[model samples]
Target chain A: MAVRDWEAVIGLEVHAHLKTRTKMFCRCELEYGAPENTRTCPVCLAHPGALPVPNERAIEQTIKLGLALDCGIAARAIFARKNYFYPDLPKGYQISQYEAPLAGRGRFRLPRPDGDREIGIVRAHLEEDAAKTVHAGGATGRSVGADYSLVDFNRGGTPLVEIVTEPDLRSAEEAVWFLRLLRQTIVELGISDAEMEKGTLRADVNVSVRRRGEEGYRPRWEIKNMNSFTFVGRAIEAAIRQQVAAHEAGEPVEQSTYDYDADTDRLTVHRSKEEADDYRYFPEPDLVPVEPPAELVERLRAELPERPADRIRRIEPAVGFDAAVELVTTGRDRLYDRLVAAGAEARVAANAVMNEVAAAGIDPEAVDAGELAKVLGARERLPRDVYLEAVARSADPGFAAAPFLEQEAVSDASALEPVVEAVLAANPEQVQTYLGGKEGVLGYLVGQVMRETRGKADPRVVNRLLREKLRA
Target chain B: MAIDREQLLHVAHLARLELRDEEVERLGAQLNDILAAVSKVSELDLSEVPPTSHPLDVVNVFGADVPHESLPLEEALANAPEREGSAFRVPPAGS
Candidate 1:
C-alpha cells in the first residue's frame, strides 16, 4: 500500500480529581475505589432543590494548579449547569464551568529527558464528576443486556479538574510525555492524585491525521478510556493505522468519538450522529461568579514551588541521583524532601526511592509515606541499629528491624574476618571454583559465612575476607 | 419564524435529549425565539474584541503522571450500560 503523507495531530482532554476532601459542588467525600456509591449525598445525587455549592478546597487547589501550569488566572470564574443526562448523572444537568472556568490558558513545561520540550496547556477548568453506571447483558457480563444497569454515585460528586490541551503534539511519545509531565505538575502542586486508572486521571484522546505538512487540519476522532500510557501508545498507533486505512479507502474521515478496544487493540467508532457543536457557552446564571481576588492569585504564584523542570536541574546535582529523569520527575521533589525529612543520607535515600520505591511504579504518596518525614527528621533520635533495621526490612516489615539488628550485631568490621576465614575453610572446594574464574561461587561462600555468623557479621567484611582468601 | 417539530427533535437527539413529542414542539418554538434574539451579537461591531474561551486566565494545573490505584476492571466497568473486560460497552448503534 502506498503510504499517504499523514500526521497524527493529537490533543487531549484530561479529567483529574482534585485532592480535596469534598466533591466539586457538594459535601460528599472525594474518594475513589470505596464501596460503590458510598461517597454520595442528596446534593451530589442531584435530588430536587439541592442547590450546589462549590467546594472551596477544590477551588483553591484548582487555583494552585493553575498557578503551577503558568495559566493567567481568570479575574472571575463561574459554575454553570451543563444540561445533559445519562444513567451515571444523578443530576439532569451537571454543574460545570461553561462560560467562566476557574482557570484559563496555562502552559505546562514538560522536560523531555531527551530535550527541553514544554507542552502547551489550552486550559484547566474545575468541574463536578458524573455518577457511574454499569451495563448488563453485554460483552464481559458488565452490561449483559438486562432491563437496567447498576448505578454508582461514588464518583458523581467528586471534584474534578478538566484540562484541555492544544493540538500541539506531533507524536504519540510527545503526547505521553505531556500527560506524564502534567501529572507531575499537579502532584507537586498538591492539587490531585493524578491516577489515570482510578479515574482521578482520565484521558480523552483527540487524534487527527493530516498530510505531514498540510494545514487547516483534518477531521479527527476522539479516543476515550485510554487508561494506561502503554495502552495509550497502542491506541494512538491503532488510530493512525485506521486513519490511513480510511483515507486510502476513499472514505471521508468523519468527526466523531471512538474507543480503543484493548481486546482487539483497535479503534472503533463511537458517536457519528452529530458533529462537534458550538456549545453556545455563556455566563452562567445560577450561582455567583467565582471572583477570586487577583491578590490571591499572586500569593499563589509567590508560593509556587520551583518548577519540576528546574527542580530536576537543581536537585539532581544535590541528590547526585542517576536514573532516567522521568523516573524521578513525577515524585522527585516530594521524594527528595521526604528523604531529607527522614534524615537518610539524601543521595542514598534518593537512590533507593528513585530505583526501588518509585521504580515499583507505584505512587509514593499512596504508600505509608509518613516514614519519609520520620526518617529525615528523627533519624538521629532513632538508634543506628534502627536505621540498619529499616533498610533490611525493605522487602518485608513483619520483623522489627531494630531488635533484629541489635541481636545480630557484629563485633565491629574486623569480627567479620574470623567468620569469613572459617567459611573459606569449610567451603574450600567452592574456593577452588572461585579461583577457577566462577565469580558467582564467591556469593555462595559469602552466604555461607553470613549463615555461620548468624548474620551478625557485616556482609561487606565477609566480601572482603572472601576476596582476599580466594585471591590467595 | 417558528422552529419545526422535526428540527427540534433532531437537535434534542444530537444533545442526547429525551423529550416527549409535545415538549419537543414547545422547545422548537422557544429555541427559535432565543436564536432570533441572540443573532444580534453576530451583527455587532465586535471584530476587534478578542474572543475568550475561558474567563479565568489560569492554565496548567496538572496532576502527577504517576498511576494511582484504580478500581478493579470489573468495578470500573460495572456501571457501564455495556462492557467488555475493563471497558464500558454500549449497545450496537441501533439496539
Candidate 2:
C-alpha cells in the first residue's frame, strides 16, 4: 500500500478521575483498594427514595481546568442521562453532559519539534464512573472467556471529567505528545492524580485515514479504553495501516469499535449487540442545571497558574526548547528558576539540576536554591569528587559548602610542574607519540598527573603543563 | 408521531422485555395514543419559551466535598440476588 498518499486524522477522548473526597453525586467517601462494596451508599447503590446531589469541589475543579485551557464556561450546564444496560452500571444509565457541557470550544497549544500546533477542544464534560469488574475463571483472567465476574462498587460514582479533542493530530507521535502535555497540565492544576498506571487517566483514540488532499471525512474506528501512552500510539498506527490497506484493496472502511491487545499487538472488533451507538440521551430530571456564577468564573480565571506551554516558553531561550519542555513537565522548573534568581548561570544550573542533581536522586524541592546555587558556582573550582558529593548532600538540612569548597583543585603551574615532568619521564613512548604528532596522547599524560595528585590537581593546568613540557 | 409494531418490538427488545405477538399489537396502539396526547404541546407557537427538564427553577444544587460514612459491607450487599465474598456476583459481561 502507498502509505505516504494517506494521512491519519486522530482525536482523543480523555477521562480523568477528579480528586474530590466524595463520589460525584453521592456522599460516600472516595477510597481506593478498600474492601468490595464497602464504599457504597444508598444513592450510589441506586436504592429507591434516594436523591443524587452533585459535589461542589468536583465542579470547581473541572471549571478550573477549563479556565486553564482557555475554555468558555457555560452559563448553565445540563446533565443528561445516557441510557445503557450492564451490571457495572447499577443505575442502568450514566449521568453525563449532553448538549450543554460545563466547558466548550477551547484550544490547547501542543508543542512540536517543527512548531507549536493548536488542538481544538470540543468540550469538557462531567460524568460518573462505573464499578470495577473482575472477571473470574477466564483463560487469561480477563473478560474474554470468563465464566463469571464480580463487581466492586467502591470506585462506582467517582467524579470524572471527559475532555474531547478535535481530529487535529496527523500522526501517532503527535497524539502521544499531546497526551503528555495534557497530563502535565492536569496534574499541575491539582485537579486529579492523572496516573495512567493507577487507572485515574484513560483515553479512547479515534482514527481515520484519508487521501492527502481529500475534503470529506472517512469512516473512523474507535479504539476503546487505552491506559498507556505507548499503547495509544501503537494502536493508532495499527488502525491507520489497516484502513490504508483496505483503501488500497478498493474496499470501504467500516465504522466500528475495537479492542487493542498490547501484548499480542492485534486489534479485535468488539461485537457489541446492545446497539452501542443508540444511547437515547435525555435531560436528567433528578438533578438541577449547574450555573457557575460569573464571580466564580472570574475568580478561577484569575487564580489560574502559569500553564505548561507558557512555562516552557519562558525557559526555552535559556536552555533551548527540548530542555525547557523536559524541565517544566518534570516539575523542576521552579527550582531552576529560584537557582537562577540566586545568581547561578542558567545553563550551568540546568545542567547540574538535570544531570548531577537528578543522578544523585535528590529531590529538587528539598534543596535550598541558594545553597545549591553556591555549590554549582563552585563546581569548576572544586574537584570532581567533591562537587558530586556536594550535590548529593545538597538536600540535607545542615548542608554547608565551606568544608567541601576548601578542597579546591591545585591550578598553580609551578606546583604541578614536577608532577607533569615525572609523568613525561615515566611514559617516554607516550611522550614520543605526543611529540610525533599524535595529539591524543596528551590526554594520557594529563591523566597520570591527575592520578599523582589524587584528582586534586586541575586537569586544565595539568594539560597546559604537559603540552608545554612535551614540546620542549 | 405514531408508534408501529416493529418499533414497539425494538423498544421492547432494548428494555429486555419478553412480549407475546398480541401484546406487541396492543402496546403499539397504546403507545401511539400516549404520543398523540403528548404531541398536542407541539401545536402551540410559543417560540419565546425555553424547554425545561425539571418543574422547579432551581439550579446549582450541590453538596460539600466531605466524606460521610458508608453502609456496612453486609448491609450494603443485603439486597443482592447473588453474592461471592463481599462482592456482587453476576454472569460474565456480554453473556
Candidate 3:
C-alpha cells in the first residue's frame, strides 16, 4: 500500500523541568549553568542517612498545570522508584509516579487550520530529572562513541513534569501543533521556562503506522530525548515512512528505540536498548502519598489564565485564525484588545502589532495602547515612514503621537497640482503611454510627483492631480 | 509460589548484579523463604484494608521552595573515586 494509505498513530511524552527555586527533594538551588556538582547536597547526592523531602512549590506548580489541562487530579498520588543503574542516577533509581499519577484523563483542544483537534491527555506526572553527563574521548564536546563520561549532579533531583498524550494525533504536523499549544499554556501559567535550546523541554515520541481505519494498534517505535520541535516532527515522519515500507514488505516493525541524526535526516536503532523494559517499580518508602486538599485545588483552578484555545476562539472572528493564534501565543492579544477599545480597527491593529511593532523590536508590554491608536488612526493621512516611526517610538517612556501626527502627507489637490504637472511634463514618453490607454503608467507619474515633493505629497492627491492634467 | 533459578537470575540481572553459581543457589533458597514468609499474609482476607506506602500516617510533607547553602565544590567531590575538574568522572554509559 502507498504511504498515504497508512495512518500514523503518534503520541508524545513531554518532560518539562519546572522553574522552581530549589530541587524537587533537596534544598539545592536549581540554577542552570551552575558549576558542576556545586549544587549537590546529602539528599541529592544519595549519601547514606539522607532523607528526601518534597518541595511544596513544585507540587503546587504541577497541580496548576494539571488543572490548566482540565485533568482530574488524583485524590491520592504516590511517588515510586524506577530502578536502574547509570552514572547519572545517584540513587540508582528515579523517583516517579507509577500507579497513581497526579493527574489524568484530560483533553487538550489542539487548534488546527481546519478546526480544533481534541487530543486526549493520558497523564501528567511529576518526576525528578537525572544528572547531566558529559562524555569524554569523543570530539571535544560530542558524546557519541566516548570512552568515559563526567557526571554533573547539579541537574539531578530537579522537578520535572512528564505530560503524556494518547496516540490521538494522526500526523507529524498535528503533534507539533499540540506541543506549541502545550508550551504556551505552560509559559502562561508561569511554571516552567520550557525552552528547548536550554534542555528544559524534552520529548519522547512514539510512532506506529497501521492501515487506514484498521481496528487495533501496531507495535510502535520510540524516538527518545528529542529537544527541538522541528527535529521531533522530522523524526516522526521518517519513522512513519520506514514503518509503512516495512508493512508493505510483509515485515514486522519490531518495537525498539531510535536516535535521530537530524543533520543526516536518518533514524538509527539503539543497538544496546534491550526489548525488555524491566524498570521494576514500587512505591518510594521515603515519601508519603499526596492528597491535595479540596480548597487548594479549587484555588489553583480559579487562578488559571484564560486557556489558549479560548483566547484564540475569542479573537478569531475579527482577525482570523492565523492572526488570532499569533496574537494569543505571543501575548499581543492584550495590546490588540486595548487598541480595539481605543477605537482602532481590529484587523489593522493586529497587523500593525504583529508586524510593524514586532519588526521594530518593540515589547508589546512596554507599548502604550492609546498613543499607538492615535498613530494608527492617522496612518492613511501620514507619510508611511512617519507612521512606522511613530509606532516604533510608542514604547518609549512618556511617548506622545502629536509630533508624529503633525507630519501628515500633503493631501490638498490644489497644493499638489504644480508638482504633478511638472512630473508629467518631465516624462512625455510615459505620459504618451498613459494617453495611449496604459493606466498602469499613472502610478509611475504619481511616484515622480511624490519624489519632487520629498514624499510629503500624498500619493492619492498626486494620483488625482495627475489624472486631471493628463485628461486635459 | 517460589521463584525458580531462571527467575532469580533474571531478578539479579535487573539489579545489575552478577551472581556466582553457589551464591545463586544460596540466594535463591533464601529469596524463596523470604517470599514465602511475606506471602503468608495473603492467606488472610484483608481486602478491606487499604495499601499503605509509608509507615507514617502523614501526607503532604513538603519543604518550601527555598534554597539553602549547597556543599562547597571541593567538599562535593571529596568522596569521588575519580574527578575531572569539578565533575565526577565515571565510565562511558552505554545506551
Clash totals for all models, in order? 43, 0, 0
DockQ for candidate 3:
0.74
lDDT of 2 by residue, A1-472 (tens): 8889999999999999999999999989998888789999998889987889999999999999899778899999999999888788998899999899999989899876567899999999999999999988878777767899899999999999999999999999999989999998999889999999999999999999999999878999999889999999999988988899999999977889998877877777876654746678999999999999999988988888899988888888899888898888778898899999999999998888888988999899998888889888888889898999999998999888777777779999999998888888899899788788999988888888888988889888888888788667
For candidate 3, write residues A1-472 as lDDT tens digits: 4989999999999999998999999999988898778899999999988999999999999999999888999999999999988888989899999998999789898877688889999999999999998888865554556788999999999999999999999999888888888998998899999999899999999999999989889999999898998998999989988899889999978888988887878788876634277889999999999999999999999999999888898889899999999999888888898899999999889999899988999888888999899999989899899998999899999999998887789999878877777787799999999999899988888888877877888877777778888889
Local accuracy of candidate 1 as per-residue lDDT tens digits, A1-472: 3445777888988888888766666665555576765565556655568666666667778888888877877777766666644656766666778656777887766555455665678777887777776656556543323444656666786778888888878778788877876777777777777887776788889988877677878888888767888887788888888888888788888888887888998987773433454344454444566778777778878888777666666565565433436435645456556556656666666665665565455455543344543443434444455454454343343333344434444646576777777777877788888888889887788788768876655666678777886777
Model 3: residues with Cα > 4 Å off, grouped in runs: A138-145, A273-275, A410-472
Distance from true location, Cα of A331 in model 2, Å: 1.9
Model 1 RMSD in Å is 9.8
State each model's C-alpha RMSD to the native: 9.8, 4.6, 4.6
Which candidate ranks first by DockQ, i.e. highest?
2
Query: Could you report the DockQ of all the candidates, in the order they appear?
Result: 0.07, 0.76, 0.74
Task: List candidate 1 stretches off by more than 4 Å.
Answer: A1-6, A31-39, A138-146, A248-251, A271-282, A315-327, A330-472, B1-95
What TM-score does chain B get in every candidate?
Answer: 0.60, 0.93, 0.94
- Model 3 chain A lDDT-worst window of ten: A138-147
Evaluate candidate 2 and give its CAPRI docking class based on DockQ. Answer: medium
